[model samples]
Target: MKTLAIIDYGMGNLHSVSKAVELVAPDTRVLVTSDPAQIREADRVILPGVGAIRDCMAEILRLGVDDLVREVSADRPLLGICVGMQALMSRSEENGWVDCINLFPSEVRFFGNHLKEGDVRLKVPHMGWNEVYQTTDHPVWHNIPDGDRFYFVHSYYAEAEGNPDIAGRTHYGIDIAAAVARDNIFAVQFHPEKSHRAGLQLLKNFVQWTGA
Candidate 1:
């Protein structure tokens, strides 16, 4: 059985994510912990976060999860969600420019003050379901359609430095990197736990993936 660690750096919706993982894959051992040893022992790791980037970064560094993430993400099937996805980037424009794990060569930028679709204005947080257009095929996207809608609640989105790393894209006020993958890592700006069928399918796929 696979052991999946949900890294709890005191900043994520750990219970919801853990419950979602369990519901998707009952056989897999889901460990929600902040201990580095437990994280190292797990076959797969999930980096999940919510709230401000500054506080998230502060907690991550304080708990030494920043190093743990870098270490485990090197070879395991690492999944990042929401601000967790943003933290994987080199930097984030949130909270006046915060440095991240630099796992992916990208930067997180805010949605700006004025965002609109035609004449109608869109909310800053980009809350609710939005269609994610798959850009490339991957094990995580198996059984999921190309333009499936996923739940998203983020003000900032990742902007990859290059196009190759982009796995999916979505439009709010502009086209943004909704999902990114490279090697053993796959990160999404949306919350799979809160996204219903499509989201559950993704979590199921992640559990079965071998990181090949």
Candidate 2:
């Protein structure tokens, strides 16, 4: 009867994420809430977001979920998705530069206006499926093979100050940190819910993970 909490600050794709988690791990209780008590009490926490970083940070601070996230992530299995992952960084170059939760010593930078792979130019959003190459072995990657493609729809990507915390990498025009991990915390820039089979497998691993 493990309880999982999806922090709802009103900016995430909560319904799809919750449904995906429930489908992958039928035994676990998935609670989508903004209450600090429920979030802190859950066996695992998921921080998810899909929107502008400026609005996302504003809501997170206004709702006091920032403190709750920090409290739970100290020793619990915590996963962050999309903008949720960006929010964990120290700062973001989005919307004239904004501060974030600083859970990891990193920064989120935009893909920039012009991006190309050889002579052809790539779009700014970097939308669609791309392969994620595992940089380090981790429990969350259990049963999931390397070089699997995951769904991505973001303009900004995380850049860790050092390479030690990066667990996965993907190339769009250049290498980008697709996933990051340290202790009980795991976060990814891509949306696992929208990623199909490999995505579901990752979520299953997260649910069964012992946080060791």
Candidate 3:
């Protein structure tokens, strides 16, 4: 049986993410845990988190999940969600600059208090559904179409800065890296569990992906 580990380091919507993965891939064994052994043994690893980047990184380091994530992501399929995604960057502008795992050569930045689009003021968190435009071909985009709306509830987003590894982009007063992929890792700034159809399809694709 296929094993999928959802890393739980005192952050993230663990149960909901576990349920969503179970819903899409019922036959797979899902383990939501912080144990390094279990995470290392799983066929696939999912790094999920919510809340401030500072607290997220603190827990990740405190639980030794930082090195674990780096080790597992070296040659296994790994998915990061929300703050989990931001944690893959070099640093985040949130909480007055917190260092991340640096899996991707990018930085997390705030939406700004004066964010606006054509004379209309936008919110800080950028909460709600927004269209994600596919920038590169990837297995996770298999059944998902370009410009499909995904659920987002983040004030900070990854600034890929024209990185070739960027897989998806979305506009919310400014362009944001919605997804990033490289080698065996795929991370997203949106919550696929709350994204409905498109989200589920993405998870399904991730479950079946071989990281080729």
Q: Which regions of candidate 3 are displaced past 4 Å?
A: none
TM for every model, in the order presented, reads 0.97, 0.98, 0.98
> What is the C-alpha local distance difference test score of each model?
0.92, 0.93, 0.93
Model 2 clash pairs are none
Deviation (Å) of 113 in candidate 1: 1.1
lDDT tens digits, residues 1-212, model 3? 99999999988999889999999999999999888999999999999999989999999999989899999998789999999999999999999999999988888888899999999999887899999999988999998989999999999998756776789999888888999999999999999999999999999999999885
lDDT of each residue in 1-212, candidate 2, tens digit only: 99999999999999999999999999999999998989988999999999999999999999988888888998889999999999998899999899999888888898889889999899989899999999889999988889999999999998743656899999998889999998889999999999999999999999988785
Number of residue pairs clashing in candidate 1, backbone atoms closer than 3 angstroms, sequence gap of 3 or more or interchain: 0
Better of 1 and 3 by TM-score: 3
The TM-score of predicted model 3 comes to 0.98
Model 1, span 77-170: residue lDDT tens: 9999999999998999999999998888788999988999999998898888999999889999999999999999989998743656899999
List of clashing residue pairs for candidate 3? none
